[model samples]
Target: MTATPPLSAQVAVVTGAARGVGAALARNLARRGAKVALVGLEPEELKAVAAQCGPDATAWEADVTDVEALTGLAERIKAHYGRIDTVVANAGIALGGPLLDSDHRAFSRVIEVNLLGSVATARAFLPALAESRGYLLQIASLAALTPAPLMSAYCASKSGVEAFAHAIRAEVAHQGVKVGVGYLSWTDTDMVRGADEDAVLKQMRSRLPWPANKTYPLEPAVDRLAAGIARRSAHVYAQAWLRGMQPVRWVLPSLIAAVGSRDVARLAPRLAATAASRLRPVGAGGAADTAARSDRSDRD
Candidate 1:
């Protein structure tokens, strides 16, 4: 018998594939012989990423927060691919600033896109995934493991998704469909680079202890994620150290509270000065999300 190729029969869908981790992960999956569906808000960037993923890959422009669009897109993907093996709910945005000084719209937008968006993606694709007995990987962040002072919205959204994925994992197991939560630290992605552009945000992150303070390269991180997808791991850690964080997660909030307050106090003046400008989401992906929302509002 001819040997089967790796992931040769797999069909994977990744949201937020326009740039950063999502783009890189899509390419990784494609390289492993999986047909990839790239979904995101940025059409041009998504097209470029799809081209890079070879002929078997295609791009779809849709907001993760839009249920109707995602539902339709999911059906279209199933029709095109004949079977869906994996779905990566990786769409997310972040804004950094004290809650009192933050843009209320931006803060709420983060929660909607990061938390509710993942839920919508699951709802849209779970049927297809169940039919194939495939996997769904929900991309969460270290923010879910440990909260920081200025990242209230991000932390809350990530934490919610982590819980959401865990709850559904049990619910879907009987159907032979697997659910996994992916945890990434500060990888050198657009979002992290964008956060570094602000002085106060940069300094605050720099003060994080040991390995957590470091920014890791993207390729190695995506490699781990791809490996996790192959195994359908319950918890995928982009950084090895992140796996070690699970046991200590319960104590992290209290530790951050005790230590972070001092840092926040020292940075208060600078934060106050830059709060207005920093109220919006960070990075190119974030910019695209903001513009997409604005365009939709105008159309409405």
Candidate 2:
């Protein structure tokens, strides 16, 4: 295996680059002098982020949930850049509903974008990463580490992302391609804003104590991501507490189960009352996307 290279002369491709943490990460990498490929569902937004990244950036919009779109993206990048040094699967959607009444389309969109999209990004770019001895960053959420009531869909999707990254990392350890999984805490992103505020999350907001004495901005996580790419870290947690939380799975599993049992009993009525879809799709005719995409995911 070879050492990870410096940002200069390196081309970093990031999904969900149009806004939020994805855009922030792109700006940080570009400032460090890395060439960047900004891929997202929104091109105009991507263009804005690209401009901020300077002349070394390119923006392309493609729904990551579409497998064909990703394949085309891979071909385009391989043709233009010849090699992509680092790839960050940063795109994800937020969805919340009771496990019973989850919208079929909305639910699938979350899983497709959060889980399948990450895997597709890796499959599409792994060759270049291995050849360049670069890095792959999979952005998982704090939800992946712990589940909350009314967030069964979001939790399941991100949990899959976290696990997939780990499995891939193990498979490719000797290929000179480093993979890192990022576990982040509650971010003030659009996803969070879009989710239905069920009683559990609301209670957490109002009552559930934050173990960390501080709540930091997304900028630090962006810096940590850049550093993770440079260092080829196996795992990166935005907040420090995640390091302790992962291993505590043994202890936490039981503790969280106990807490969840209490919360679920109290929150069940609110969860049951959420009969119809709580989401309003932000774009197009608003027909449907995630949950409507698949029935199996809808049930999840």
Candidate with maximal TM-score:
1
- Please state the error at residue 278 of candidate 2 in Å: 2.2
TM-score of each: 0.94, 0.86
Q: Which residue segments of model 1 deviate by more than 4 Å?
A: 1-6, 283-289, 293-300
For 1-300, candidate 1 gives per-residue lDDT tens digits of: 222225768999998888888889999999998999999877888899999999999999898888999999999999998988899998887778899998788888888888898999999999998888889999988888889789898889889999999999999988889899999888887667756768888899899999888999989999999999988889999999999999998999899999999999999999999877776765444353445431111000
Q: Check candidate 1 and list the clashing pairs.
A: none
Worst 10 residues of 1 by lDDT: 291-300
| Clashes within 3 Å, all models in order | 0, 11
Q: Model 2 over residues 113-221: C-alpha lDDT tens digits? A: 7789788888888877778877898888777777655667778888898889988887887887778888777654444433313444446444444652133477876
Give me the candidate number with maximum lDDT: 1
